[model samples]
Target: MRNIKLTIEYDGKRYLGWQRLGDYDKTIQGKIEKVIKLMTDENTEIIGSGRTDGGTHARGQVANFKTTSEMTLEDMLAFFNRYLPQDIVVKNVEEATERFHARYNATGKQYSYYVWNAEIPSAFERAYSFYYPQQLDLARMEEACEKLIGKHDFIGFSALKKSKKSTVRTIESISIEQEGSLLHFSFVGDGFLHKMVRIIVGTLLEIGAGSMDVSAIDEIFENKVREHAGETVPAQGLFLDEVYYR
Candidate 1:
């Protein structure tokens, strides 16, 4: 069997998320798997680097599947793009080592959240960005971002109720850039739990809006209480920007 790596990009506004749940539910994985079955006659399982929440977008989501077919990678890529829905695109395909597992071998991930910080919301970008009419303090948000960087337990910021798996993850960097009426937030992290990035972004926004103190970030980290954290922002603003592997 040959392992094939796929770099995918999707709008994800209409799908139920990345994972395939049942035959009826619309999903990114389910759509691609259906195409693969038509091409190879195998119920191939596509293992993704991570799951993106419903309505979330992705620019460079990675997945892998093993196949017994001898089709060329170029043919496979073309086949996927041809059969899959218009919203999901298989950007690239490559032959991967047998030992390569998309989820396990992934070293880190990059995610970005966008906020429309203008009084007049953007009509075209409504589906892609969160609209916040309030003016935000960029300096305060930057200070909160500094407190979130480095290794820390992020359970407070995640939606997970309980788990034995370690919630501690390393956030290498968080950058906030403002261009016109848009605010772009980027995060590079070893890993993230469910809704972790959204929650952190919400917290930062609150701090910027003067509703929450910047020092509250440290308290949330030290207390490890989910209630102490800010709301989990809307999924539409979040994007799985890239998956890192080495």
Candidate 2:
């Protein structure tokens, strides 16, 4: 068997997220698997680097699957593009080592949240960005991000019912930047919990709007309480930008 790695980009507006849910009719992983089975005429299961919630887009999402097909990587990419839905595309495909596992081997990930800070609705970016009318204090939001750039118990930032193996994760960097009416919040981290990125973005939004003080960031770390954290922002604004290995 050989491992095949694929780089994917998707518009997540009409899907049920990345995982294969028994009840859900639409998902990125499910759609990919359907196409793979059709192309190879073999039962194949694709494993992704992470599960992105419904309506959350991805620019460089990585996935891997084991297959015994004789098709070349280029053929596989072409086959997927022809069979997959228009909104989801297989950007690249390459043969990988048999031991390669997309999720397990990833060393870090980068996520970006886009905010449309304009009063008028943006027709082109409406589906991809979060619309917020408040004037943001970019400096204060940047200051609050400094507290998130280290290893800490992120229980407060995750969903309440998540029973993950550990809540402690290291964030390599967190940055807030504004370009005209668009504000972007980016994060590089070793790993993340469910809703972690959205919660972080929500917290920063509060700080930007002058609703939360920068010092409150420390409380999120110290308290380790989910309720103490900021709201979980909409998934449409979050994008899994890239995944790193090594």
Highest lDDT scorer: 1
Clashing pairs in 2: none
Q: What would the per-residue lDDT of candidate 2 be over residues 54-109, giving only the tens digit for each residue?
A: 99999999999988899988889899999898999999999999899999999999
Candidate lDDT (C-alpha), each = 0.93, 0.90
Model 1 segments more than 4 A misplaced:
none
**Clashes per prediction?**
0, 0
Per-candidate alpha-carbon RMSD to the true structure: 0.7, 1.2
TM-score of each: 0.99, 0.96
Best by TM-score: 1
For model 2, the local distance difference test gives: 0.90
Q: Which stretches of candidate 2 lie over 4 Å from their true place?
A: 162-164
